[model samples]
Target: MTTAAITEETKAGDANGATAREGRGDLLDQVSASPRPRVSASSSPSPSSPPRAEEIAVRVVGLVKRYADGTEANRGIDLEVGRGEIVSILGANGAGKTTFLRQLTTELRPTAGRVEVFGVDADREPRRAKGMMGVAPQEAGLFESLTVREHFELFARLKGLAKREARAAAAEVMCGLDLVREARRRVGALSGGQRRRILVGLALLGRPPLLVLDEPTTGLDPDSRRAVWQVIRRAVAAGATAILSTHYMEEAERLSDRVAVIAGGRLAAIGTLEELFARLDKTYRVTWRDEFGAERSNLFGTFAEARAFVARESLSEFSIARVSLEDVYFALAGRRLTDAGGAAGGTNVTGAAGAAGETRKEGAR
Candidate 1:
């Protein structure tokens, strides 16, 4: 589809008045009374025994994307998202997160792969696959002249809701995303953050079984981010599945049932936080400053080793804490979550998390 046409199709939607906590009848119920698809297993099964087609909300195998310039944006990517689950994709710029999602959404054709959504072959039947999904691309435009309510109602109708049903869905989304107060305001008058929320609300219009959000919380402040999180959680609770890509570590840590780390155009690791942490030999991290005052960090196999190193070094300013998803990302992607810089504050230890019970001196490998 042309850019203009795509925008018109997805441009308009709702925004919450204050927060999703506004207590309007459960947004899900007001939007769709039908039951959400459910999987017999709560999560995707091990790769050795993949979940049945019906139990899978989304499935991709050997997904590859190559541009005409000979750049392979996505290479051999494979993933499975179970129904009623939330999966977060993490990666730095150019890591192919967007490329991967675009292929899944069928906006970009893959060089080689199979993508299925709820048992439908997306590669073969893009329309049928898209009908079962609510997609919020990383970037989409909203109509400047349209009011918030108009955006929501019109999009709901376009998604096949009747006039009355569209109006109800619009109101529910407006209140749920804190856009009620701006119901009549033109999209041109809204702030960027508010505009972003409106885009999110658009995806929630018909309550499609799958929600694909690419950095839905990109520009919002903390509270707004949390509000969006709540909205997504409610949607999932009501039986929708969500797959989102985000740069925020905390978002991935708190919002996802499973996290997939995309590095160098491939999926480097995929698992729960605990499962990822267990992959690290160094479970504890110590942060301190060298005599030169440059920040230094070291990973240890155990808390005892971390504490001992601090005491042995006669350090008065130091902290020892459990490694986090940030560490995991560093281990897998070789970059920090906050920026496209080398891992935070020192030599990257994700690959070599210090020898067991050994404390290396500052900058010493």
Candidate 2:
């Protein structure tokens, strides 16, 4: 499908950019020393109209990342994320999801292309650009010697909060993530899920205008995962834009205003779930075990068509279900979201809005 056809742009007004003198490793340290910058403003009002460049929270054009060994992790990706929206990047492991995020956060410099965060050139002014965002990497080291409350308060302070403000922000974040009870517990003493929550909490500390999270809920249980989801929703609700990369189909389906699929180090498809679903010709999926007990699957436009096929094949064991985001990934990326192998090329389905129109749900702005 043409990327332009599925890509959604929401215009925003304007946001002030900051200037800092530190690198990624010293981001927090610099924040602690420098004054906090003002948060970015609101998003565009209408989806149908074109947005001004300033309305976009994140703008990436021709973004490319090549390692020293000549490995191209990202290849000319272009995307625009509006303010006050949550966009999820989905892909199989090593499909360049993290690579794309790293470049966006200025953690890794792109070999080519430009990145703008709230109208600031991240590549040229990494510190200033980073000041407008809060990031949660796929893996981050925490202070094991510090208590949970200490971690939050200290990070909040590092984000330019005053001692009193830092304490209050810490309390609010802990309470929101259900980590209040573990407030006094040492980081090394907490469970893995609890530690994960702490990482998310750190990003939410200063309520930065933009959040860049890499699998924020990877190791959490159902309840804890939902807690993080709520926290994200609250952040967006309060006017912050979020961009996250996740392996969970449900997370992408439920949390994102727009879902982007990365395959072979490139954006393969992107749109609302309905927009992506409409790209497919069939609405139902049929799966069954064959004579050798191996599984087989097919898509059908109607239930009757699927049933008829089963009867014709004389298959005794089969099941039919509705097509979902997972199917969309496979159809557009030519592989499952969980696959580790390279993409094999995509199905014939291309472009958006094929058939599923009535079921389309307007994404929350």
Candidate 3:
């Protein structure tokens, strides 16, 4: 839909003059009554074992989200997060990735279907459902007036960690986020990368069984981004399940066990990178311009398959290439992930305004 035709569903008040929070009741009732799918986290690792329903930590069945302005942000999406799995949702801007995540965490009510986290309905029991979740939004959500310790303190409190225990947890998290030295410094005074790291740290503060991070590394220098990757891996290793939303295909390729491509609010594809590529039937395109003035290109399933073909065909001046996740992103979204949001979201995650709040609101990754 065009911008002129869209009304913001995120506006301040509800249609009834009550706060929008009250409007959630009807959605909550539907969510509360829906059937739940469960999956166990500690089942045996047999390769041939089929995934059991009880082993799923998060499930979205026929999930749909439509904005008040008639824009459907999620068009009948079905997704599952196994115990301890990192499932990445990849898309370009306006592709409905974040909107879908918002549904999983109950920040946005689904217009149809349900979201279940650890056997609890997010729509019906949002608070109880959230207790099992830790969400790190793309935008830096830290309060400028609060120090690193205070930031984690707020999260720990929300997660039900006690005061003295919360302080200890905050210190440990600050150390991991590389903000130990700034624990006492006001968040407003920290550098951009520092704040981003701290936001990640806060998400981990609760030690929730399920973690949902929206654009966890949108902004930051290469080093800071790498640091976040390390932290995420650690989180997964500890048996916590995670859902990552990101525009960076490389990040998703490296971290996710499975990924779903969203386009214009629809789920275009869902599977492992290899599985989706296989389903798309996209082949490795080997291209070469020969001395004989002929342009040669070929498709192969495996690098070995391509190599054998090259030798058999005696294609001397050939280059072998495979479809990249970035390629898949474009084929599904109709635009480059990096280009849709632009490099600006990464470099000026705080956006151009640079007022601390503006900067904080600029980027989430």
Candidate 4:
């Protein structure tokens, strides 16, 4: 299938680019900081778009991280997450997503670029940065030395809660996470889901304004997954802003106010689901049975502009519907979302083009 026929991802194909060339030799975390020039706001900020005026919770501007081993992880990607919004960082492996997450939480300092968490320069004021944010990594980071109550106690202390207040805060967290029953259980003995719950519980201890989760449900069963979603919703209701990196498309769809699709360490698209779909021209799906006992389905950009087509062709099997986020993902990426058919590092980024080819190739079979 032609790339355009399958996905709606637009790119200016130069797959092999300068960033990829520079970041070829460092350890995963040791990737060199991006060497790109910085981004400048207009002397007069655009009040119409009002990016600066808006209470943006997280702003990533021209982020580039190039490892010393010559592996470039991020390449001039720009992103903005508004206050109280849930944004999804959607990408395949090595898409610079984890790096983005690390930088925001002050876990990995950016080699270059500015990360403003709650309107502060994080690099210049890391303590201030860490103080206002909560992080739930893919792997839980609780201490094996502590019991559930102790784990909560430790995190509350980290948030600067006094002894009595910390205890009170811990109690609230345990109640919110439905972990009161396991308050005395050692964290080391908790199951994976329980562990994730604690991770989230730790982040929510102080009702932080910003919450960052790195694949918060990596090993969870369906039920546990829903349980975590509940916790996230409660956090948002408490006026928190969240940015989560996830490969699970369904999770992204359900939790995100907008989704940012990243490829080759650059953003392919960023918008609400409907806004992204609008990038596609309206189209129709036509299906019918052939004389040879086969079913044929095809997509068209137009319905032959017929007023009576729907009435005339009462084919019950064919229904009019809008494309889903999955369809939009396929259209933009030019491949099946589930078609991860390669080795451990097998992913969809095929080149280092400064910019990928910028055409949504109409791909229909």
| TM-score (all chains, Cα) for each model | 0.80, 0.79, 0.70, 0.70
Candidate 4 lDDT, 62-86, residue by residue in tens = 8888888977777777788888778
Compute the lDDT of residue 71 as modeled in candidate 1: 92
**Which lDDT tens digits does candidate 2 get at residues 164-220?**
999999999999899999999999999999999999999999899999999999999
- Compared with the true structure, model 1 gives a TM-score of 0.80
Q: Which whole-number lDDT from 0 to 100 does residue 178 have in model 2? A: 98
Off by over 4 Å in 3: 1-50, 280-320, 338-365
- The sequence of per-residue lDDT tens digits that candidate 1 reaches over residues 122-164 is 9899999999888888899999999999999999999889999
Better of 1 and 2 by TM-score: 1
lDDT values, one for every candidate: 0.75, 0.74, 0.66, 0.64
lDDT of 3 by residue, 1-365 (tens): 21111111121112222321232333322322332122211111112222368999988888988888998888888777798777888877877888888888898899999999988999999999988888887764568898777888877987899998898889877766677889899988998888878878877885778889998888777667766776776677778888989877666766677777776677776665545444423334454544555544444444566567666656656666554555445445544465445445342222122111111112332
Residue 113's lDDT in candidate 3: 91
Candidate 1: what lDDT?
A: 0.75
Better model by lDDT, 2 or 4?
Answer: 2
Global local distance difference test of model 4? 0.64
What does the lDDT read for residue 303 in candidate 2?
Answer: 59
Q: In candidate 1, where is summed lDDT lowest over 10 consecutive residues?
A: 2-11
lDDT of 1 at 141: 95
Off by over 4 Å in 4: 1-54, 282-322, 334-365
Query: Which stretches in model 2 have alpha-carbon errors above 4 Å?
Result: 1-51, 342-365
Q: Which is the winner by lDDT between candidate 1 and candidate 2?
A: 1
